[model samples]
Target: MTSFQDKAILAEHAIRGVLPPTPLQRNVHLSEAFGADIWLKREDLSPVRSYKLRGAFNAMRKVLAGDPGKADFVCASAGNHAQGVAYMCKYFQVKGTIFMPVTTPQQKIDKTRIFGGEHIEISLVGDYFDDTLRAAQAYCADIDGHFLSPFDDEDVIEGQATVAVEIEAQLGGMPDRIILPVGGGGLSAGVRSYVGDRCALTFVEPIGGACLLAALQAGGPVDLRKVDTFADGAAVGRIGVRTFDRLRDVSLVDMIQVSEDRLCITMLEMLNIEGVVLEPAGALAIDALKDLREQIAGKQVVCVASGGNFDFERLPEVKERAQRFAGLKKYFVLRMPQRPGALKEFLGILGPEDDISRFEYLKKSARNFGSVLIGLETKRAENFDALLSKLEAAGFTYTDITDDEILAQFLI
Candidate 1:
C-alpha cells in the first residue's frame, strides 16, 4: 500500500505536467496586521482559478490509466468543481457532462464552457443543487460514465492532498499552523491526512453553511436544514460520508464558523486593501485569522486562499454587506411630522461626517406624519451613535432596520 506521503508525491508529479505549482507567498500586510509571519497558499492562481482542478485532474488520470478505454466523465457542481472537471476532461480528450443548477450565475457557466471548450456539455437541470446532483448521478448510471464526486472519492482526496505536498515543498517545512476552508471536507481532510499532526490545523467555515461543524457535533454527517449560498464554493448542506469518516476525529474546538456578513468584510478588505479578488469561500481562511490573532501571534502561519472566482457584478452587494458589518452604514424607518420645519429639523440632527445615501417617504398621504426610509453612511461607526442619539433627543420615532434581515430583504 502506498503511504499518504507517497500518494501525495505521486499526485504532485502527475500535476506538474499540467500546471506549475501555485505560488506560496508571504503576505506582508497580513503579517503586519496580525503580528505574525503570514503566508498564503494561492490556490486561486490555478489554471481554473481554484485548487479543485488538482483533484479533478488527478482522479481522472488515475481512472483513465487503469481503464484506457473509459472516455466519459460526469459531475454535478454549481461553480469551481464544474470548471475543474470541464478543464480536465478537455485536457484528457474525453467527453464530460456537467450538471449545474438553473440558478448558477452566467459568469460561472461561461467560464466552464471556456475551460471545457468542445469536449464538454453543460446541463442546467434544477433550481437547487440536490436536484442537479440526482440528475447527474442517474445520467452517469445510464451511460456507464465514471461519476466524479466533488469531494467524496478516495482518488479526489488523494489529488487534493497534493496541495499539502506543494505547501511543504514551497515553504521548506510545515509552518506552525495551517488554516483551511472547509466545504465538503475534501481539501481539509486531504491536507490533514498529509500533514498528520506535523503542524496545527484550523478549519474555517461559513456560519450559515457549516456542514463540517454540524457533522462533528453530531458525530457523523447530517444534512443542515438550510444553507446560505453566498459562499457558493463552500456552501455545502451536508458533509460527504467518506470525508466525514476521515474528519470525524477532528476536535470541534479546532473549527471556527465565520458569519456570512463577516466574510464580506474580509472579501472587501482583500480587494480594496490588498488588491486581491477573492470569492466568499476563498476568504474563509483569511477571515479566520481575525479570531486566531492571539494564538498565532509571532508564529509562522499559512492560510490557504482557496479560490478567486468572484463575479465583478456582485461588487455592489459585497460592498453593502461589508459596510453593514462594519457599522459604517445603516437603514432606518423614521416617522417624521408633516410640518414645514420637519425635514430641516431632521437634516440638522445629522452628524458632520454622516451622509444620506438613501431617502424616501413611504406614506406621503399621511397628513400628520410621513414614514421615511433613510439610509445613512458615515466615515466612522461612532458617528451613527451620535446621529441616533440626536434623533432620540429630537423626539423622532425611528426603527433601525440595518440589522433586521427580514426587513432588509424586503424593504432595503
Candidate 2:
C-alpha cells in the first residue's frame, strides 16, 4: 500500500493541476464574533462545490493507474458526492454510473448530469440513500465495475487529507485549531491524520446524524436507529469502518454536535451576512464556533466550509427552521371560544410587533370552544414572552408546540 502521506501529497500536486487551491480566507464577521482569528477553508468553492471531488478523483486515478484495464466506476450519493464522482469520471474519461435516491432534488440531479456530461449514467433508485447505496453496490458487482465509496476507502481518505495539505501550506503552518465537519468520517479522519495533534481538532457533526459521537460512545461504529437527513451531505446512519478506525480515539469533548435547526441559522447567516452560501453540512463547523466561543477566543481557528450545493427551493424551509430555532417564530394550538368577538379580542392581545403568520381552526373540541392552530412570528424572541403573558391574562388557553418535533410534523 502506498503511504498515506505520499498519497495525500500526490493528490495535492495532481489536483492543483486540475483546479486552483480553494482559498483560505480570513472571515472578518466570524473573527469578530468569536473574538478569534477565524479563517474559512472554502471547500465550498471547489469545482463540485465540495471537497468530495478530491476523494473521488484520487480513488479513481489510483484504480485506473493500478489496473489499466479498469474502465468503469460506480457510486451512490444523495448530493455532493454523486456530483464529485461524476465530475471526476469525466475528468478521467472513464465510464461512470451514479445511483441517487429518488427523493433527491431535481436540481441536484440536473447538476450531476451536467458535471458528468456524456461520461456518466445516472439511475434513480430507492427513497433513502442506504437503499440506493445497496442497489448501487449490487449493480457494480454484477457489471464488474469498481465501486467507489464516498468515504471509507483508504485512497479516498488520503485524498481528503489533501485538504489539510493545502490548509497548512496556505496558512504557512497549522492553526491553533481546525474544526472539521464530519459525515462518514473521511474528512475528519484525513485532517486528523494530517494534523497529528500538532493542532487541536474539533469534529463537528449534525446532532441528527452524529455517527462519530455514537461510535465513540459505543467503542465502535454502530448504526443509528434513526437519522435526520436535513444535513444530507453529512447525514450517515453509520460511520465507515476504515474512517472510524482513524477517528476512534477522538475526544468527546472535542466533538460538537450541532442541532439541525441551530445549523439552519448558521447557514442563513453565512448566506445573508457573509454572502457565502453553504449547505447544511457545510455550516456545521461554523455553527460549532457558537458553542466554542470561549475556547476559540484569541486563537487562530479554521472552519472547513464543506460544501455549497444548496437548492434555492429549500430556502423557504431553511428560513422557517432558522426562525424557529432562533425563537423568532413559533406555533401554538389555541382554544378559542366560538364567538364573534373572540378572535378580535385575541388579536388585540397580540403586541404590536407580534404577527400571526398562520391561523387555522383545527376542530371544535367543545360546543363553545374550537381548537385553533396558529403560527406566530415576531421581530424579537422576547416579544413572545410578553404576548403569551397577555394572552393568558385575557383567559386564552394555548399549547406551545414550536419545539415539539412530532407534533409540529403532524399538526403544523
Model 1: lDDT equals 0.93
- Over 1-412, each residue of candidate 2 has an lDDT whose tens digit, in order, gives 9777676888899887678999999999999988999999999999999999999988988899899789889999978889999999888888999999998888999999999999999999999777999999999999999999989999899989999999999999999999999999999988888789799999999989999999999999999999999998999999999999999988899999999999999998999999999999999999999999889989999999999998889999999999998999999999999999999999898888889999999999989999999999999999999998999998999999998889998987
Candidate 1 C-alpha lDDT tens digits along 44-73: 999998999988998999999999888999
lDDT of 1 at 238: 97
RMSD, every candidate, angstroms = 1.0, 1.2
Candidate 1 pairs with clashing backbones: none
Clashes of 2: 0
Q: Scored by CA lDDT, what does every candidate get?
A: 0.93, 0.92
Query: Which residue runs does candidate 2 get wrong by more than 4 Å?
Result: 1-3
